[model samples]
Target chain A: MKHIIVYIEPKDASSLKRTSYEALTAARSIAGDAQITAFAVHGSEQALATAGNYGVQSVVVAKHDLLSTYSSTATAEALAQYAQSVSADTIILSGNASGKEISPRLSVKLKAGILPDCITLENDGGTVKAIRPVYAGKAHIAVQSISDHSIIALRPNVFTAKQEGSANASISSFTPNLEAKHAGVKVTSLVKNEGRLDVAEADIIVSGGRGMKGPEHFPIIEQLASTLNAAVGASRAVVDAGWRPHGEQVGQTGKTVSPSLYVACGISGAVQHLAGMSSSKFILAINKDKDAPIFKVADYGIVGDVFEVLPVLDAKLKAMLHS
Target chain B: MNILVCISQVPDTTAKIQVSGDGKSIEKTGIKFILNPYDEFAIEEGLRLRERFGGTVIALTVGSETSKEILRTALAMGVDKAGIVKTDDILDSYNVAENIAGYAKSISPDLVIFGRQSIDFDSSGMAPMVAEMLDLPSISVVSSWNIENNVITAERDIEGGKEVLTCSIPCVISAQKGLNDPRYPKLPDIMKAKSKPIEEIASCHGSALVSLTSMVLPSSKRVGMIVGDSEAEIASVVTALHEQAKVI
Candidate 1:
């Protein structure tokens, strides 16, 4: 890649999201001698400056009144316009909700190809090839851009955000001429799940399944999660039975998580559920059935009933983590 | 309100997948194909909208001849019409979006809907890409949707929580898992759907922008250490997580 543009999404009005930093680190890794430019819309000076810590040489803050509120069309228009002005050949963004929503539009605007939710990217003799999980992590496919310009969305929590340089990124502003029609999709409001960790972004997760028997028994799973400071997860069956929210469902139709540690409680490890979390760094499966498929992928397996095993596990972890 | 619902056929989630001999695609033999799970919600939403507002619900898919099965499923689910852009080649998302957008333009539907993502590719790019191509506003992963007076208010999942968005007609939506429970086709409807005409459209074969290089199964590197249900075994797991895995 010659000139790379890394799209930055603000966590709030002032700071960049953790995934944005990881995008910068990813761009730096594949950039080689290429110039890396960080792009954002209506971000604070403090937020733009932090890109330097992630090895960005310069930053471009695109500005417009309509752009202040996140609109897929308007943001994509600004990114496309700026990329064209700078003659950038590649655009890298995080594969979070906003990024996933905008990257495809940006790709179409720039007449480029997109590699979405990519886990690994390699520069192969002047070509960038990426490996992304398909079929919900059951299989992976190596892909490359056949178009002149390419857009890559990196999967969250996969790439490490590292500070390779100690220089501040030079900041510039670009004001794209946008019309009212461009602000077609408007975010009226956001309802934050305060204090609850999302499984998609959590480092550790304790998940329940059909083996939990009933929704009333979930506190056993939650206590263990609380003791570990991890997020709570559930199997599709549990979520379907109204025992958990859809957001906490971990499986083919739900969130795909690759946390540092995953604890499966009462989950039987259906192929669909396994497809979502088989990539965790460490897995601990607890079940009464000794032959449950979850043990095949778990690093540690404790064969016992959840009712009997969870309290002890929670107490043990509480003692270990606290002491 | 003319609604257009797009869908895809994917291998059953429970079906085992193997990399084909070409090393670039999955082995399809002995695999049972099913309607993409998320698309069920898309089709259901389309049917519900048609029931509320007077409109024709059309289902479309850009895939090979085998994809017509999903169109039949949509027909059984009460779609007014169905069509397929037939092609055998493995088109990338760009071309797929191009064809779907092409059909949407020809029909000029007031609303376009799709599943959040296809289970096979799992890219989640269709609705937005097609929306951009048609130059219309779009919302994705919508869990709750309300429409009145050509205005759409939707609640969708974001990273940490829910986001409420509003847009006018001539918009696009992608359904999330919790949108609605799709209805299964009855025996009579399934029989009636078999006779429904599936209009075959010519594939708009554009040069693919992205190409698959290879495909492989993910290798497991887990250290499978099994323990009994004893209190000591439970304690040992905590110790292993603390010292050995060091994740604590």
Candidate 2:
């Protein structure tokens, strides 16, 4: 039987990230009746309890005083030890910042096959096959591992989280044999972007492009996003032009978001920008240019000035939501 | 202090990408190649670090001879030297990391830097894997950094915030976009870069852990309808989004 492990990270001090549950769902699809374990470092009890509802048979937490904060070396060392202890044939993780930092180190420690940013995965008669985007989402490539063990990082928002009854998963704790090297790196402080939701996790995103004019004009975009309870995103042109923070960028070189609703304001669509948000369920484009490429993919397009259209749309939304 | 920058050559961001007839690779005809934009930040950071601390910055790449073009771009951006780990085969992330780690071990630089992720593969795996192989601390997606004495303090973005990390020298850092604005190469510097000799080393070969089976373009998006430009018409569109699309 194949043994699978999903790495779960805390969304905060108390809860697990939604992407972790999505990783669990991916793990379940791979491990039919076989063993599936949820692994976390300094994981809270609530996080473990939630993993139990997602079909995991066991949960492993690596606890240590030094792990109160994230250290890439320490986390990778702990995860590698746990994988070896369980003889895990496959390991899955969310393709978040932490996962991107740790999975490569863990893969090296275990000498396993590694695939990051996978959008689709299937168990092909015990050998796992995955489909991932390449060339900045311009194309998709199918890949399979040739190693004894495989490490996979699933992109966030792609996999749907599903719970299958109560698994009653057993919990266990282990102390990793960390060395002095693991302590070489330390996180001193964490400053949250306060009040702003991450674009990758938001259900709806209202993104601005170069047509927004300057950094000062972003407040209007922010106002609209706040009205819809959505995150703010910017095209690469604006981000590179220093009109927006890089974290807010959505395009080939920035965050790829697959939200339920993506509203583009004053954005002349580039293929690179479309690659990032084309997966949205509903795209709404508002631009003065009638022939902008964004209109082609938008569920609804408006050829009007963003300054004029945005206020009307914002007002209409406020009226509809009664807020 | 010595610094090493890793870079990749990729098709221009706006290039029209087409899948090859064999369905295994991209058609390279008439494609304009440029140094990966993210790597530009790395090259710029390397140059800035060398300026602050007396050191040499060496730019490296693991690819075919054509990849030397990227190294030349780095040289034009003020990197002291350039090297190419020449390989003709399609190496996986593991092999790529292994080869880069081998070269890094030989030079033993004070710091190794890379772009957060290559726009082509979007792997974002190499820098950390190289660090693991070298048994050094690593920070990926770093937006800002400072070095006091030998300790490096770096800030990187997380889910909804930023984290401040500290590590000593001989660490690996991947440059995020907001780190700095990359400098444009002057005509004189571009000409000078052409004369610099690139040190080409043969790459170590190993069986790739993951192999590509096939490649295809993403499914096409739906052709949408254009609503009118008037306020009344725009209101109708928003109403349709709420009632008909049920997305609002």
> Across residues A53-152, which tens digit of lDDT does each residue of candidate 2 receive?
8877688889886676778889889888888987888889998888998889878998888988898998888888999988867789999888898899
Q: What C-alpha lDDT, on a 0 to 100 scale, does residue A315 get in candidate 2? A: 88
Flag regions of model 1 displaced more than 4 Å. Answer: none
Best by TM-score: 1
Residue range B90-120, candidate 1, lDDT tens digits = 8899999999999999999999999999999
After TM-score superposition, the amount by which residue A71's alpha carbon in candidate 1 deviates from its true location, in angstroms, is 0.8
What does chain B score (TM) in every candidate?
0.97, 0.93
Per-residue lDDT of A174-243 in model 1, one digit per residue for the tens?
Answer: 9898899988998989898899999988999999999999999998898888888899999999998999
Rate residue A269 of model 1 by lDDT. Answer: 97
- Docking quality tier of candidate 2? medium
Q: How many residue pairs clash in each candidate?
A: 0, 0
Query: How close to the true structure is residue B238 of candidate 2, measured as C-alpha lDDT?
Result: 79
